[model samples]
Target: MTDQHAPVVVAARRTWIGTVGRGHHERTETDLAAAVLAATACDLRGLGNDTPTDDVVLGSCTGPGGNVARAAALAAGLGVGVPGLTVDRQCGSGLAAVIAAAQQVRAGDARLVLAGGTESASRAPQRAHRAPHGLTPYARAAFTPAPWADPDMGAAADALARRRGITRERQDAYAVRSHTLARAAHAAGRFGPESVPVGDRLDRDERARRLDPDVVGRLRAAFTPDGTVTAATASPVSDGAAVVAVVPESVRRDLRVPGLRVVATASVGCDPALPGWGPVPATRAVLDRAGWSVADLRAVEIVEAFAAQVLAMTDALGLDPLGGDERVCADGGALALGHPWGATGAVSVVRLFSRLVRAGAPAGARGLATAAVGGGTGVAALVEVVR
Candidate 1:
């Protein structure tokens, strides 16, 4: 194993079981955090380790009191002595936590770490929308607002599609494929292992359910009064959590854990006014850092925050249109499966894990994951399936 500090390599390396909150449980942020921690503890038990974690890193976009990580660690049965920190990077929080944790291990500051994210969009904080008063006339007119753009994400998606020549019909078609693949994967139990059952009432409530095309077609657009982007094509507000175990390569060898390796990871910022295009630069950065071409990737998982966003990146990356069977998010994406902000990153990582195991893909088989965030920030990670 490389030295903990001054290591030349850093990777996500290992993942534990991923847990989702009860779909119908109506859980609070605290409840969801506790549930995720419990699930992580159970996973650690499966790995046959009783040692206290060196550190805990939790991510939540709308965490209450901004202390979800510490609260979760304490609730999960970890000793009070264990340290924890919380992170919020909007939709990319989970991935950001993973990245930060891996860096710590690589930097030698930590050896054993628990990294994951949780969010209860159902319990999202309510705040009065306020406009900045200090901005100059030029800035006020030209600048986008916080929490969301002035016109909002849906509106931005609509404008982008129009500018990029993407049609409403094409976006709808992508949504249909998302539902179909999601339904098939659920039926076949592709997500059975990765998903943890939540709530005492509902034994299992996977968010990726089948959608009615007729009902989808009847829905009105959200952003544009007469635009094409509808709730059907956009990700739903949901509650969920996912956790990963990060350990040094040497420690992984000692544990004898299978399937451990890192490929590439990158983050980038773009024009906040045109936030929908954030993933394009982020994807390019990851590929450039890893010295791999798009064609070299076996599968891609671009967070479907919006249909047009995914469509825009597909074109930018020169990927096949969503209709093709070869494209990623084969089991649907945020649109059909739901996006729990903080948990979405881990959700994507878990999906990639399932895909690799199912295909029995060889080592070096590349998978790319990317997400666009609120502040024109985007993150991308590349993983190679290890055998």
Candidate 2:
């Protein structure tokens, strides 16, 4: 492709995140993804036939082994002819899926694509191996090589917190801020625009209202007896889905879809031991590719798998973590909203979409959405308002 067309996100939407085994406990992963995909497609429908998309690309980590994307596409009534691709790349899967869709558009193989991620922690099947003897419950899947020292995500976060000198107090404070902002945003109806209600009610984020300062301060370490990481500071397991409509810039005018144009994308590998720091390199790489600086971005959304994870990235990137800076997750983050592993990264993109496109921010407003992966990888993308 000589003159590759740039990719742009025209529509974005997400399901109201619900606590695991609560609001969406009965919903399947395919159904959640289909719901969000249908909402996003409906958002595009206003553009008429110009909104036609070529495929559906989805991401998941704990979903059933088969091609969940195909199931979701069919369930969403996207037509049996539309091909679907499913990707699993740990925590970064969602953003990576969006990047993959954008690449297809850039390569001219697709004019429009539906890309995002979904997760149903409540409905995820418990793993167990059948054996001649009694079956043993599976604890977790390997995320890295045996030699790389694979630690459970919570333990890894605790290790990073200790290494970075991030105190338990700091993590708790950050968690409090997340809930405060998220609740305030919710009360102001800020989330209504991007979130779709589910199951006979306008579902709200269950974790956003669970803030208790004294309770958080007294919580014990979740992974280690003396570690800093705790349940209060970590993102809760939740069920939800989020997706975006990606179209080539060539069709933006014809479709009258005003949104963010993709500027650059990056996926970088890092040390598996310190997974929380992955976003630092990922964001830097994307900015370098676009020849832009941190100063160029008006907003940033680095998924908060844990409060310490976000703080570590802020420190590495020279951002003010406690200064009430509006550039970083102005509304809130996963700590308050809950993290549906596979969908968390795409939720960050939806945050950017709401801030840059729906909020009527100044023209050319730029934002970067980035995330750290479980297996020593970081993924990020830089985008700007097309107007």
Top model by lDDT, which number?
2
User: lDDT for model 2, on a 0 to 1 scale?
Assistant: 0.87
Name the candidate that leads on TM-score.
Answer: 2
Tell me, what's the RMSD of every candidate? 5.0, 1.8
Scored by lDDT, model 1 comes in at: 0.69
lDDT: worst 10-residue window of model 1: 7-16
In model 2, where is the ten-residue run with the lowest total lDDT?
A: 1-10
Q: Which stretches of candidate 1 lie over 4 Å from their true place?
A: 1-25, 128-151, 203-207, 212-215
Q: TM per model? A: 0.85, 0.97
For candidate 2, write residues 1-387 as lDDT tens digits: 213388989899999999999889889889999998888888888667455669998889898789989999999998888889999877888898999999999999999899999999998988888888978789778888778978788888998898888888889989988888899999999999999876854368877875788999988889988789988888999999999999888777677657888889999988898888789899999999999998889999989999998998888888875787778988889998989988888999999999889999876899999998887888999999885
- Clashes counted in candidate 1 amount to 1
Error of 2 at 351 (Å): 0.7
